[model samples]
Target chain A: MTSDVETRVVRIIAEQALLEPSDVKMTDTPVDLGIDSMGLVEAIFAIEEEFDISVPFNANDPQGSAFDISSVRSIVAAVKSLVADQTT
Target chain B: MRRVVITGAGTINPLGASVPATLDAMQEGRCGIGPLEIRDVDRLSVRIAGQVGGYDETAHFDRQQLSLYDRFTQFALLSAAEAVAQSGIAFNGALAERAGVVLGTSGGGLNTQDDNYRAVYEEGKNRVHPFIVPRLMNNAAASHISMTYNLQGPSFTVASACASSNHAMGQAAQMIRTGLADVMLTGGSEAMLCFGGVKAWEGLRVMSKEACRPFCATRTGMVQGEGAGVFVFEERDRALARGAEILAEVAGFAMTSDAGDIVTPSRHGAVRAIAGALRDAGLAPERVGYINAHGTGTTANDRTECAAVRDVFGGHAERLVISSTKSMHGHLIGGTGAVELLACLMALRDGIVAPTIGYREPDPDCALDIVPNVAREARIDVALSNAFAFGGLNAVLALARA
Candidate 1:
């Protein structure tokens, strides 16, 4: 189930950055994947839509946002946690 | 006392995308009001709007920029670019620090809101785009223009409905005249032609289903328009020092509130503002040659505005060339006054006054010299742009030949 969340989040992030999932690295930050501020927002929106879970992301101060968008792997973990909380 | 002058003017309106193109359209008395182009057009009772047609957003902005800038902000930035380019004033060092941006918009990101609301309510989407807050904020255009031009002094947005642009420009002029800043980018933009926008206006019933015919006996209601007009207001001496071609002098601006009605305009309030503008500019009413009446084509607005002009200028109202370019470009709401200033410039610089088209028979209530149906050659020394918004807020700007 965690792996499913990771795959879906990675695909959403890749789609927002206009890249293939294969091109997106687990350790790569959203900026490294060419995901701008808006791109990150789109990716987060897509993830929330996919999982039916809320993401605590704020556009005004993205760095200080609770959702860890520093790297692809971190975003996946954050989504997994949100999904688990929602389901439980 | 310091003076403020308009060194550059730019607009992307329904008439045309630039000042030269818009002026040409005005000279020919061209009408830009046409069919509804946005989504859900079938649902709107008032289907027509003056849309900025054939604008290729991809040609103007990159994908990254497209994601961030809503339509209103895009209009603001594009018009500001043209004005700043024409002015040839590079914001550097202290100039960059002192220069600022003040833009007006009644609906900053109504399109964004409309889109998201549709997604959530109509489409049953659970999530919204994360940048919705920034995109929909009223000050987004002003903030973006300040960022693009590196203006650091004071930047903000004013939202007084239709009077927004005039009020914003008035504030910028006051700042420059009172030694608050040296150069200011001031104007307004509006892009509220979305489906939700039209639906909301439909509830008010102030919109026309067919056309905008201001001062015409057959007129019904106002037509909505979407676009922007940005101008560079620099201290007169600074513009002269740089040898910038001054377009017009921002002689005076006056604002008044009726404190009377939420929707209907007050003739006394409008008259006071018109007279106060002349008093502030130190020009007699007879010195004014042109008046851009806030002839919204609505029965109440046209009659009230004409009465106000008559009250202020008395006998001079009949002699002055009065016209409503809203008859051409449509009512731009917050952006109307700024774009109408172009008509003042046309009257002052080229000695050509834009006409009020779509007129069939004159109504006795609005019986002023409405340069009807055709452009005229007039040696105008002074011009006034009137903007009366909903909620009884009125702002009028007085301009003189440069």
Candidate 2:
């Protein structure tokens, strides 16, 4: 199941950053994968385009429940859940 | 009143990032417009814009900083860094607080908004990156500039469609003149060249399909652009005392509104803005050697701007070297005036006047000596920059040799 999730994570990075699965190193952080803020934004844009969700500016305000995006896998996991919710 | 002068300049436009490079590109009439490659543009109406090229976000900032800043903010910070680095002035405790920051932007984190919308509705993602607010707000650029340089002065953001930067620059100058601050980092930034972002422009129905052709009879509409241009403004006395190189004196500034329609521009308003700026500068209309026009290339804007010029200076309008740098840089929206003001300062410093590229035929209506197509070499005594935006916001800045 983790391997399946790993593939989906690789696909997310590939789809958003205009990179190949090989380009995205699973062992690497977003920084290692060359995913900077703008690239992260492009990733977010891709997820939005792929799926159709409107996330507000501050979802993770200490006052609020902002989800952690510590790594590519985490972002992918959150996105998968969102996609699952939509499909269901 | 204390006189305000431009001490340094920096930018990252479609053409190039640095002063000499960008000016050289514009002087050579380099068009930065190309096919959109940011996203899948197969479905979008607008396929091109003057997007900044070769911008590496992580290289510029740490991961935590990147998380907090939007692309526009990062552009602003980078541009501001360039300006401060070139200034050769160190900001201490007192100067930092008195030295304010005023930057402008039409779309604050708009790309973020578009992407977030996509993530929630389509991707079903409930988790957004924690720093979305810092990335998207219009003032993030100003804040970042202040934090980076220890500038605590009156820092704020200006939003007035494309006129935002001009307003911010003018306001910063005013703050210095009023003895509010000793220095300021001023200008504008914008990077809204995304798919849905570009699509929103289609609603305006005033964009060119091919390229931006300002002042040319074949011109269709304004071309969109993305980037930032920032300048360090300081008191002439302070700069001289500190042995700072004064680029050009920011002599006067004036802002007005049409109070009419949102989209359609007003000739009266344009005339008021130009004339008002001249009066504030306390110079005869003939004294201004160059006029950096807000020539948006739209049929309505060009005609209205031409009439306003005619109303103010009459035959002198022909004598003055007037041009729209927008022909090449596209309408940078918020950042246009900052770069345009640089054109004004450049005209003041170097004798050569920037040209309105793509100008083929003078629409009989806009029959001013619009330094057509080619750059002209002439010593400029005084230069004026004009910026008029949606909602009828108008800001005119006057500059002269120090």
Candidate 3:
């Protein structure tokens, strides 16, 4: 089981967009929030920079059906996995 | 038709803000790419970036001008002010509305938007910043330029991915030729060295691992950079009447689109842009002495750009002193073409072609005179600066000795 940084991440995203955390769905993708490709890039970049982790640049090949990585939960999950791997 | 000439130019590149410092670094063939300074790179796969450090507009800002400006526009406006001030060109009473401004930018206010996102998402806050809209909009910098310089002329921002600055410069030159504006403040600004910004770019998968090695077989991709580049372009007669320092003549400008793919560059677009610029400059291909390539050091840009050069100029491409200042300055994206154009103008003015530093190996496809790893002094009568961007935008500007 991983600690949920997604909870904090969701809260952060909600605060930035002036949306209630209650309105934020953990599975909802960045696209649902009107975060275009450019916006998504910046959001992901900001998180990586903040957490000091090297997230994979291309999470999914352009052609593949990428993981539903649109949510704060998924992003934080990815981050936690990296951190845990380093510690182990 | 009015003849446009560069009266003043200024920049805040990774090598250092001033023209002299950055030029010194360019002459010595230094790379400004390094690890991220503003963000925690512990987790990002891409770690390095070219950054403009500790440039607080508050230190150099006028109190009244601060309200209308976002950080990116603030940077461009401050640089423009410095340029116009140094140009010694007096603004005519009527030039305000007719004297235009065209600024280039790919990412505008991403830094401020990131902060606003942090505020709302992390804090679960309700109220966004009051200035968020103005700060986040792509045209904010151009708006600020108009207001700051009392420019009522046709003012707009050009956002064609990395080609934004060259687009702006081309359009400004067009305005002068069409008699739409007598004088124009043209350049670009970007602050993409921020945390969130880098993350977004990493997804593209074209970024380089070490330094940008344009025209090199060992090249990886481009090193991201952030900064602003500005030039004050005025009609030559107007400049002479005002005793303005004529840096170089903006002889010809041309633009094209690859219309091929969003990401991959089209050699077709590149070659046409080169040919179009040559025709607009009223010169033969062989008459051109040098080329400031849109050498992003990425595999796609360098190769396609070279093919384009060879296609247009033939054997002369081998003799041409082609170089990318991005080797030293990194890719300023939207601001790249503007500063690269400045480098081209400077080359024309001083007769010294700056080098492409990280070019160690010879890329077979990129077979051109890539002023590899060192600067060279030459007789440059006409120099062309090339800008090719994502989404197939291509722009070329020609500068000749006045």
DockQ-derived CAPRI band for the predicted complex in model 3: incorrect
What is the full ranking by DockQ, best candidate first? 3, 2, 1
Per residue, candidate 2 scores C-alpha lDDT tens digits across B254-336 of: 99999998777899998899999889889899998999999988777888888899899988987887899888888899888
Query: lDDT of all predictions, in order shown?
Result: 0.90, 0.81, 0.79
TM-score of 1: 0.82
What DockQ was computed for model 2?
0.01
DockQ of each: 0.01, 0.01, 0.09
Report how far residue A78 has shifted in candidate 3, in Å.
Answer: 19
Docking level for model 2: incorrect
Task: Please name the candidate that would achieve the greatest lDDT relative to the true structure.
Answer: 1
**Candidate 3 regions off by >4 Å?**
A1-88, B62-68
Candidate 1 structure quality by residue, lDDT tens digits, B196-252 = 888877655467777888988778788999999999999999999989999999999
| C-alpha lDDT of candidate 3 relative to the true structure | 0.79
TM values, all candidates: 0.82, 0.81, 0.82
Query: Which parts of model 1 are misplaced by more than 4 Å?
Result: A1-88
Q: How would you encode candidate 3's per-residue C-alpha lDDT over B323-344 as one tens digit per residue?
A: 9888888899899887787678
Q: What is the C-alpha RMSD of each candidate to the true structure, in Å?
A: 18.3, 16.0, 8.7
